[model samples]
Target: MESDLLIPLIWTVVFGILLTLGVRKFTKKQPTNKRWVRPKSTDEINKSQDE
Candidate 1:
């Protein structure tokens, strides 16, 4: 019946959210700096542009 399908679908969604939160909690707390680079200040920008 539709109700049976709905119940399983709801449970699946709940389980997915719980799993995502659990995995996030288990991972490291450090910020990911590898993908980011420091931005140049105005002086650095002007110097680069002057070169």
Candidate 2:
């Protein structure tokens, strides 16, 4: 009887982990920009502001 209960409990844990990993794998945030660009400087910020 204990072995039967243990088997279901182990399966439940395994299923829960698999579900969490699947959800995370599918629902992950995708990067909008793939390019690695340099950061804007203060001068660039000021120029845009003046424009």
Candidate 3:
């Protein structure tokens, strides 16, 4: 009975730690030119239509 509780408690702590680490990794700063980031230029729409 005690072992069952212990296993889940340990797993919960480990999972919480892992989640915090993963969140930190993703939230950290990176180069602004990364593909997922949108460009700041408002002229992009105009330029695209002219193409």
**Residue 41 of model 3, lDDT score:** 82
TM-score of each: 0.53, 0.58, 0.52
Against the true structure, candidate 3 has what lDDT? Answer: 0.89
Question: What is the C-alpha lDDT profile of model 2 across 1-51, one tens digit per residue?
Answer: 699799999999999999999999999998787798899999999999999
lDDT of each: 0.91, 0.95, 0.89
TM-score computed on alpha carbons, candidate 2: 0.58
- Cα RMSD for candidates in order: 5.0, 5.1, 7.6
**Models ranked on lDDT:** 2, 1, 3
Rank list by TM-score: 2, 1, 3
- Candidate 1 Cα misplacement greater than 4 A, ranges: 31-51
Candidate 2 global Cα RMSD: 5.1
lDDT of 1 by residue, 1-51 (tens): 699799999999999999999999999598766877788899999999999
Clashing pairs in 1: none
For candidate 3, the 10 contiguous residues with the lowest summed lDDT are 31-40
